[model samples]
Target: MSDTTTTVDRAKRGRSGSVILTDRRCGKRVANRTKIYDRRCPGLYVSIIPAGVATLSFKFTDPGTGKQRSTTLGIFNPETFTVEHARSRVYALKALDPAALVNQLR
Candidate 1:
C-alpha cells in the first residue's frame, strides 16, 4: 500500500484498538468505547461510555493551584461538535492570560 494509505489505516485502527471504535473498513459504530486521544492535538480527548454517550474533554493545569485538571468541554458528536471543536477551545484557553482563566473559573 502507499504511504498515505498506511497512515490512514493506522489511524483507523488506532494504536490500542481497545474498543472496536468506528469501523476501520467503513465508517460505522462497532462498539461503545472509552478514552480516545486526538493525535493532531495534545490534551484533547473523547470518551465513549458503554451506553454510547460521548463527551469531549480537555486537560490543563489550574493556574491558581498549580495543579493539573481536566474539564469537560461539551457533548462530543461528529454531527455537532467533535475533536476540532475541542482543539479550538484548547487553543483559545491557551491564548488566555492565566489570571483571566482563573477568574472565569470562579
Candidate 2:
C-alpha cells in the first residue's frame, strides 16, 4: 500500500469556527446562542454611551504584558429606544463592525 497525505487550506474556510468574543462584564465569551435583530432608523445614530446604550468598543489583548484593553469604536442611536432593542442592536453592531457599514450608507 502507498502512503498518501491530504492537505487542507484553513484560510479558505469560512470562519475560525471556534473563535469567540469575550464580554467584559461577565468575563465570558459571548455565545452564538445570543439573539440579534434588525430595525429601521432615520437620521444619524451614535453609540457614545460607553456604559449605557450598548456602545461599540474593541478589546485588545497584549501577549507580552498579558494585559487586555478596550477602546470605544463609536456612538450609535440604534433608533429603537428600548433596552431589549438596544441589546439586539449592539449585537449586530459588534458582529458587523458598524463603522464600515455606516460609512457605506453615506
Candidate 3:
C-alpha cells in the first residue's frame, strides 16, 4: 500500500476555502476544510456533513493491513457542523486509530 497526501484550495469568489486530500493509489478524496475566525486558534472551526445525509463521503484506510474503509462523519450542516467540531472528531478518530482517517482521493 502507498500513502499520499494532497491539499486543495476550494476558496470560491464568495465561498469558504477548503483543504482536501487526494489518494492517488486508491482514488479517494477527503475534505479537510476549517474556518478560522482568529489567528490564535488554528482549526477552531470545522465543517462536516451530517449523518444519514446524501453527500460525498470520506474514506479511511488501515495502515496495518492496507484495507480501505469509509464512514460518515456528518452531514452538511453549515450552522451546526462547525470547523472545530469536525476537527475534534477527526482528532478523536486519529487518537483511536491513526491510520483510520486516510481520506481517499477520486
lDDT digits (tens) for residues 1-106 of candidate 2: 9999999997555333322222332222333322111222211122222234434333434334566544444433335243334345445545554455444223
Top of the candidates by TM-score: 1
The candidate with the higher TM-score, 1 or 3, is 1
Query: How many angstroms is residue 69 displaced in model 1 relative to the true structure, after the best TM-score fit?
Result: 1.0
Ranking by TM-score: 1, 3, 2
Worst 10-residue stretch by lDDT in candidate 1?
19-28
lDDT of each: 0.64, 0.36, 0.40
Error of 2 at 89 (Å): 17
Model 3: worst 10 consecutive residues (lDDT sum): 21-30
In model 2, residue pairs whose N, Cα or C atoms come closer than 3 Å (at least 3 residues apart or on different chains), thus clashing, are 46-75, 46-76, 46-77, 47-75, 47-76, 48-75
What shift in Å separates residue 76 of candidate 3 from its native position after superposition?
A: 1.5
Model 3: CA > 4 A from native = 1-57, 97-106
For residues 22-102, write the lDDT of model 1, one tens digit per residue.
312122233646576666666666666666667777777888789988888887667777556767888887788987875
lDDT of 3 by residue, 1-106 (tens): 8999987665543323344421121122235432212122322222222222323233456676688755555544446653345455655666664543443321
The runs of at least 3 residues in candidate 1 whose Cα sits more than 4 Å from the true structure, single-residue gaps closed, are 1-33
**Among all windows of ten consecutive residues in candidate 2, which has the lowest summed lDDT?**
35-44
